[model samples]
Target: MSDKTESVSTLENAMQLMIQTFHKYSGDEGDKYTLSRAELKVMLTTELGNYLGNAQDKNAVDKVMADLDANGDGEVDFTEFIILVGALTVACNDFFLEYNEKGEKKK
Candidate 1:
C-alpha cells in the first residue's frame, strides 16, 4: 500500500472516500453542496454500479430521489446523501452476516 493508505485505518479511508465521492458528483451542476437529479444519476451509475439495483433506470433514480429528499427540497444535500450510503452499508452488513451464518452451518 502507499504510505498515505498504509497510515490510514480502513474506516478512515472509507470515510474520506465517501466524502470525496460526494463532492466529486455534487459539484457537477447546481449547488456545489447538493446533488441534482442528473448528478445523482451519474453518481449512482458511476459509483454504485450494480451494488444498487437498476441505478441506470430512470424510475429507480426517481424513487431514490423521492425517498432521500426528506426535506422536500428536491435536491439531496450531504446529510441526505449520507443516509443513502449508511442504509446501503447496513443492508450489506446484514447480507454478509446471513451469508456467513449459512456458510458456517454448512461446514
Candidate 2:
C-alpha cells in the first residue's frame, strides 16, 4: 500500500480505538460514546491547563456546540460526538505530521 493509504488506515484505526474506549467507559445511553462540542472544548481547555488562562469568552465553544448539535438538543449525542472527535483527530494528526516533517527536514 501507498504511504498515504497507510496513513489513512492508521488514522482510521486510531479513531476506532478511541470510539471503542469512549463507549466502554461512557456506556450506551443516549449515545454516550460521542462527545458534544462543549464537552470537547472543555476537555481541550482542561488539557491545556495554564496555557489558555482564564478565557471567559465562550463564543467559539458555543458556536461549535450549536453547530454540532443538529437535533436542537441541549446536549450532544454519540453521532455528533464522533464527528467532532474525527475533526479534532484529523487536525491534531495533521499538526503532528507537519511538525514531524519539519523536524525531519532540520535533521
Candidate 3:
C-alpha cells in the first residue's frame, strides 16, 4: 500500500472513494466535472444497484436526475452527487438503526 493510503483513516478513505467514484463517472462525457443524464444513469446502475433497484428504467433514472439537479442545470455536479451520497448514507444508517432496535425489542 502507498504510505499515504496506509496512513488514511476509514472515514477519509470513504471520502476519497466518493470523490474518485464521482470523477470516474463525471469524466465519461461532456464536462469532466459533472454527470450528464447518461453518465448519471450508468453510475447509478453500476455503483448503486443494491441501494437503488430498477435503474435501467428511464423513468427511475429521470426521477433521480430531476431530484438531484438542485440548480436546475440538467446535470449533476460533484456537489450534487455528494449530496445524493450523503442522503443515501443517512437513509441507510437510519434503516440499520431501526432494524437493530427492532431486533433488540426496545419499544
**What is the TM-score of each predicted model, taking all chains together?**
0.91, 0.52, 0.93
lDDT of 2 at 63: 69
- Candidate of highest TM-score: 3
- Which scores better on lDDT, 2 or 3? 3
Instruction: Write one digit per residue (lDDT tens) for candidate 1, span 1-107.
Output: 45555587899989999999999999988799999999999999998996986888899899999999999888999999999999999999999999999999999
Per-candidate local distance difference test: 0.93, 0.63, 0.94
Lowest lDDT 10-residue stretch of candidate 1:
1-10
Which window of ten consecutive residues has the lowest lDDT sum in model 3? 1-10
The digit string of per-residue lDDT tens for model 2 on 1-37 reads 4566545578688777766655553443444655544
lDDT of 3 by residue, 1-107 (tens): 55655587899989999999999999989999999999999999999999999999999999999999999989999989989999999999999999999989965
How many angstroms is residue 11 displaced in model 2 relative to the true structure, after the best TM-score fit? 10
Candidate with maximal lDDT: 3
